[model samples]
Target chain A: MSVLLDPFAYSFMVRGFWVATLIGVTCGLLSCFVILKGWSLLGDALSHAVVPGVVVSHLMAWPLVVGAFISGMLAAVGIGGLRKLSGLKGDTSIGIMFTAFFAVGMLLISAFPSMLSLTTILFGNLLGIAPHDALQLLVISLFCIGVIALRWKDLLLFTFDEQQTIGQGLSVRGLQLLMLALIALVAVAALQAVGAILVMAMLITPGATAFLLTRRFPAMLLYAALLGGGLAFGGVYLSYFLDVSAGGVVVLLQFIVFFPILLCSPRGMGWLCSARGGVR
Target chain B: MRTPSLRGLALTANNGSIAVDIQHLSVGYSNGVIALDDVSAQLPSGAICAVLGANGGGKSTLCKALMGIQRPHRGSVRLFGGAVNRMLKRNTIAYVPQSDDIDWDFPVSVQDVVMMGRQGQMNWLRIPSRDDKRRVAQSLERVGMQAVARRQIGELSGGQKKRVFIARALAQHARLMLLDEPFTGVDMTTENDLLDILREERNAGTTIMVVTHNLSSVPDYSDQVMMLNRRVIACGPTAHTFTATHLGNTFGGVVNELLKVTGAVAGEGNVAMSRSQLPEYPQ
Candidate 1:
């Protein structure tokens, strides 16, 4: 208790709390869309794409968020364009392009030997968050959440039955593009709190875990947010106490919770076990 | 003539007037092999219409064209008085695709699936209010799935699943229901129920079109039957459309045998059928 109090007393630790909480909440909420669309790979791709931007920003002493956002969105557009023009399927094209971008990001990092906190980008250095990163995350999370709240039903329909939505005159492509843009923003926001390697876990794991337990879209979103928040809070605390990396631990924590549900979940167990089980 | 019931378009079905008007219509893959070649036709509204043909007859392509799901290389589709651009005015239009096209294992409740129809009726950026919910409930009742509304869509039987989709179309207040193949995998009772629903909707002023290979139901369910073997062989009243001559033209020598194949019309999964089964028509 005393040690926890001591950390809170420090301004930097306070900022870390604000920043991690924002990442956890936002990643939790936004991940529902990712999970539903089975676009979990997208989170990994977008996060990797931002690395080159992060490196360039670090070299120029510019803000990392700007680089991350621009690079992430670019990767999304590039992936879409390549899929369309190349006549390859979406997953294959996105996978090939984003992985190459990630490789480029890695090459950039290796070239910059004096780069600050490379491991921090992976495991996240919540202890060293500046007041600005924390504030920026807060503002961005609010913006994403606000937009999600306003169009929850439409987004849900688009993710689940996009063809049907298009048939009914909804702009399925427009909504999907908008979602990809939002995903880019989310990837950037979560980058510092969970690092590139584990950022996708944050974006997909919680929503997937929650999806096993709920049927309605609203319930899934809410529960995904809570589950994500819980994983972040739990992982952070457990890692601090156990003296390990929080991001990796959080990813593990998510799977730990999901595995049990996967065994017993009405929809999940059947899917995982290859039995025709009822959906929740 | 179909009744204009429940705030939807019935295509003014009586006069054999063209419900779908298209000219110089052509559709093809991105690789650029044309499926439809400037086909022109006017399907009068209200009666049940079928688009029948051999494997490469472009029957399905024609259906895709009418719904605006596919682009016509050089033609237009007028749903009512307006061109395809006015397709939005037919907000009540409903589509029932083949059975296997849907992933039954998908996690969706019966009611949640049906409520998707209400999205079009509700204003932009608004949730379904009491009226919408009432209509949804009424639709479930009509489809006899009210008790199973909370059940996941995957849990239903094949026939039940089709019924649920039809109920969803009903929830849309659709006056123009385009069913790709509603009878596949369904029991006779389910088939009859669907036919009756179509009749009820028609009497209440709904226009319907079905693309199918099942020949038996045509006489009982459809008022108009259009045969195609990559081209419109014959189209007119049900009696005229059902002659052995038209059946032989559309199915070749296997018309009777094809009927026993079960689950072949608009086959997306176990029930899918395509032009691959037919003899080569030399390009």
Candidate 2:
């Protein structure tokens, strides 16, 4: 029992746990929309795109969160513009935009190596998270979650049928822009805990796991939130005993939990097993 | 004529009041392809107007124009003697899009899909009131799909999917319903059921516009037919306007083969030809 409770006794561990859980919940809620809209790549793109923002913020002495968010939004808008103007497919536009942004970040880092640590930006240092940074994460998580809750139905309808949503007098374009902004915000919020390299997994895995477990959207949302928050909590706890990277452990646990459910859940590949026995 | 209900506004059943008025509407793509050019038509309230044309004949463009989706370079569209945008703002227009427009694999229930029709009436947060729930139930019951209201949308058959969308339109209590290729994947019996439902709605003083390439059932369901080939070829009562000349003009070479297969080209006899007997027209 003492071993189990040992991690919480440390202030840094408690802070890390709260930050991880917050990111998990926020990313989990947004992930449902992401996967449903087939914007999984967009999540990845926005995360990596924030690298330049972080670097630029360090040079300009501005808030990293503001820079990251502005960079993410710029990447999103740039991708959209490329897709529209160049007649390029969605994946191609996303690929071109994110890579360019990441390259710029790398170039800036090399030009001024003393500005920021690439290792920290690439892979987060959750244990060393500052108090102010944790508070920022808390505020961002609350904001993202609040926006999603307020516009849940509109977003669902827009994702399900964009044309019909427009006919119903809802602004599909506005909803799309709102979703892109939310993705950027969530990516920024998640950056400090998971880092740019692994934030995509944080944004995708929970919702995907929930998708295989339920047939209703509301149920999917609930299950995803539970899975994301619960797995993140467990991952942080296990990381203390394992003495491993908390973000890496969290992402690994997500996949580990996902596969078993994917193979065993009724909505997943369980039908394959049942069919083999001629029971289905 | 059926008496217009209290829900019906100044628009009366078959009273010859124009429900949709399109004047010289022209829509063009940026690629220099003209989708619609100088199109004009007036459809009466409390009737089903079948907009028949070949693929790319601007049938879809017209639907988009009426729904206020595609902007027209020339001319204007009015619904029930008012601007299209105004009518849309009033929640007076409901659209049933083509099958390709929806993500059928989405994890949404039939009840939830129907409830979406009540979005405009709901509060800012889109919380469904008791009345919204009641209307959704009533709409599903009207379409004989109440039994599957809780089922996931993807679990439904093609006909059931169409019925769910129709139920959604009904839940909106829309004055005008626009259906794009509603009969595309549905079977014969389901098609008939859908037509019956449309007729019932027309009787209840709702104007319906059905955009279809399927020619066999046009006369059976539509009170008026607007044969279009990028522009209106002919527009009038189905009995007089759904003739071989207009069809040949709208469909070009394809209608010659169709006319040869089914001698019953105009009037009620058009229904005599079974769906399979008709020659396959290029979509």
lDDT of 1 by residue, B1-283 (tens): 4322211222333445456666667777776666777666666666667666666677778777766668777777777656553675457467776777786655678998888888867877757889989989998998789999998787888889998889888888765788876777889888888888887886676678888766554555666667776556676665444555566566676653553343333222232122233222212
Judge the docking of candidate 1 as incorrect, acceptable, medium or high.
acceptable
Pairs that collide in candidate 2 are: none
Candidate 2 docking: what grade?
A: medium
Separate DockQ for every predicted complex: 0.40, 0.55
lDDT of 2 by residue, B1-283 (tens): 5322222323333377889999999999766789999998999888788899999899988988887889999999999999887778788788998877888778999999999999878899899999999999999998899899999888899999999999999999888999999999898888988888887888888999999888866756777788899989998777667666677788887777667766635334333233344555666
B228 Cα displacement, candidate 2 (Å): 2.3
What does candidate 1's lDDT look like per residue over A1-280, in tens digits?
Answer: 5986555666765676667766787888889888778788877888888877777778887778778777888888899889878888888988998888777777877888789566866667766667776777888889988888888778877887755675576777778877887788888777777788888988988888887887666787888888888777777666676777767777899889998887877666655555664543
Instruction: Say which candidate scores most in lDDT.
Output: 2
Q: Give candidate 1 regions above 4 Å deviation.
A: A1-7, A56-65, A110-123, A270-280, B1-13, B53-60, B89-92, B228-230, B256-283
